[model samples]
Target chain A: MTDRKKTTIVLLSGDYDKVMAAYIIANGAAAYDHEVTIFHTFWGLNALRKDENIQVEKGFLEKMFAKMMPRGVDKMGISKMNFAGIGPKLIKSVMKKHNALPLPQLIEMAQEQDVKLIACTMTMDLLGLQKEELLDNIEYAGVAAYLAEAEDGNVNLFI
Target chain B: MTDRKKTTIVLLSGDYDKVMAAYIIANGAAAYDHEVTIFHTFWGLNALRKDENIQVEKGFLEKMFAKMMPRGVDKMGISKMNFAGIGPKLIKSVMKKHNALPLPQLIEMAQEQDVKLIACTMTMDLLGLQKEELLDNIEYAGVAAYLAEAEDGNVNLFI
Candidate 1:
């Protein structure tokens, strides 16, 4: 018998806060007995890999960039309008101070929660990303792959 | 003199887990005498409106979707992710249990904290939205407008 609860989320942005939030949510969902999966595409792909050195920038132009763009994900240059501002920074600091898990730890938590992690084939190919670039145990998938998972009455969301 | 000890967050993602996490962190920031602000745009706009009718569907599919999505703005479609499983429904539930604020109320709290609320003009235009479409008392701006506010270096973020 198939499990009745499932959800699919495609994470396209690779900003620290966005990814971290997803990780936290996936763990919370798991506590509720929901199966989870994450599809990383475009800028979000940067986070799936283990060796990426991206840091949440805290500079003048970076600050300005955050205010106009939609914050972190928008700043990853994903062909969307930028909405950068101070609201997010405050939250990040507090989370960090309260000992929020780092990105790697968040991914680990998601995995522990049975959250499936997928890398978008199109974005990976365009970006020239190799399987070695992403962390181990991650599946490479296409739009069809994601759609198939979403087809099982599981909700699909584009984050 | 420029006021000090204010921490602001510019929330761009409407993901339920992320939004609620930001608020929990905001409450933490407030403890440190930091002011918090959450700017809503695009998908995040859904989390801000007070009169949104979040219709929950019945059956397995609806249950799955609900499990993946957050109930209100704090549990928003905030991030640009498509969580593959256990995403929406779980987020929605926890937000309700935690008594988290919707995007509108979160905005109001920021105002109460003297935090500025700015909506992105570019996102509004791209999404074919009007100022009237947003909650009242929101200051509207293009990228340039948000940049002007971000210029002040009180700490910023993109979530």
Candidate 2:
């Protein structure tokens, strides 16, 4: 418990709060006094953008979804099945409201908390993005890079 | 913006922290003053057990993995991948640490939050479970049942 070691999380999804979930978990891990690292890959890279402002849906169905559904990104953290057209937005707003850490903060906190923030090299290549496109705080590595970390122990999470 | 309705979320993952992520998201939804429902099925059913404890690694390597990886169920929420032995135990410890939300509480939360909690009847029949075996709060239905809730434009998440 008190002697807990560091934990690494590999986040694959790009949705706002799904990525934010990594932040929450990383922050929580740091809170529990574990060293935490987050690796962002594929769609997950969206949140790492320096000035990322992906638009919230404003159409009718999306609007209707917003009404009948939750209000922010914190509620929409699922990677597989998606429901409301507006789910991701709601999840985000809630995360913001809750002061749940953002990717930028998570990265910074990981630094302050000794958590690692890595961006998947393969995902970056596939997306035609350079490492510079990511937030200034990220460390770039390959799948092998993550595997090297996961190989360390039982606590690895593919978030 | 003000005209937007509350978003609804279906917390559907059965994996370790994925389930917890669902709860965190649901809790976030609740914070947003919206509705949230977590439909438990298959492996996710394990997280809802009244007597079962969440999994943690006892092996030296596992302990090491546990420390270096995500620490709890709330931290392990990710889509399925072939990561050798790291999957299940990571799921367990987290479920245990989160105090495990009961199927009933998930259901009640849905009711209170104006979210619908539906246990996949197909998964139940396939898994040899009955609605009665589930916490009393859960309602049983097939894909038709889930679709009934999903058909509306509310938020749906398959964790």
Candidate 3:
């Protein structure tokens, strides 16, 4: 292993605000020259989904989950004060007013900064998400990979 | 400074399942002889609350927060499938059937193992949670203290 510090994050929540926080920290760590990795698992996988529907074969439960979950960051709701979808809109407007980047842009910034983003293959199977459903240029791995990175990480987080 | 590996967890979600996961990991790390600290913040503070109500003076918003949030681990809902509070009960029953310890008991075990439990004072102020409202023997700190612990932590997680 190199001498550079490593920061590993396990993104487990599907909420917009939580995902944004994860990306912000990842970008900050990358800017500091840390080797950063974000492992998306469970509901967090929703954040990496492509905005458009992907016509892929799936079982009934898988189809139901795909239909129930949000497609991408823009469609996600805030963890708190999500008053029937109004909270996300309100926060986006507030973010614009304050000249802050939205969640999608923050995610793009993480990619631009070369933060290694991985989708948990186990959860993808459980949730019925195929590789075609997720964004391009992201890797797929299981928990063992996450543990390998986290064990040596200077900053490891499950967000 | 010691040779023992350190695990620092930022408990940010009040969901019963999430809190249980944090405590489970903390307890496991402590059992493995790692120094563990759980920094409770935001909704996570609710996990440290005493089950009984404590009469304390508070502003309107704080009072409203106290009234709305769950009093303790037992009262907290699961992050997913919380069908109007039935989820907690169902999980509790399942835990009992499997002979697994409940959240409160898991917390007790953590304390028994000497895991450092810290309540975020800033969040306490924002949520209007006084010391009297929380459990005894736990320390109160802010983000700076959390950062100090986390920066040196071998396994730092924000759960």
Give me the candidate number with maximum TM-score. Answer: 3
Cα distance off (Å), candidate 2, residue A134: 0.7
RMSD (Cα, Å) of candidate 2?
A: 20.3
* Reference-based lDDT, each prediction: 0.55, 0.51, 0.87
What is the per-candidate TM-score for chain B? 0.61, 0.53, 0.98
**Each candidate's DockQ score against the native complex?**
0.03, 0.03, 0.23
What is the CAPRI rating of model 3's predicted complex?
A: acceptable
Give the Cα error of residue B113 in candidate 3, in Å: 1.3
TM-score of chain B of 2: 0.53
The alpha-carbon lDDT assigned to residue A106 of candidate 3 equals 84
Whose lDDT is greatest here? 3
| Fnat for each model | 0.00, 0.00, 0.41
DockQ of 3: 0.23
Q: Candidate 1, which segments miss by more than 4 Å at Cα?
A: A52-92, B1-159
Local accuracy of candidate 1 as per-residue lDDT tens digits, A72-149: 231232222223433334333334544545556777778776788899989766655567556788888899988877
After the best TM-score superposition of candidate 2, give how far the Cα of residue A94 lies from its true spot, in angstroms: 3.7
Chain A superposition TM-score, candidate 2: 0.66
Clash pairs, candidate 3, are none
Per-residue lDDT of model 3, residues A1-159, tens digit only = 999888898999998867876886687788777888999999999999999989999999999989999999999997865778966775576456446678888888899989999999999998999999999999999999999998888888878
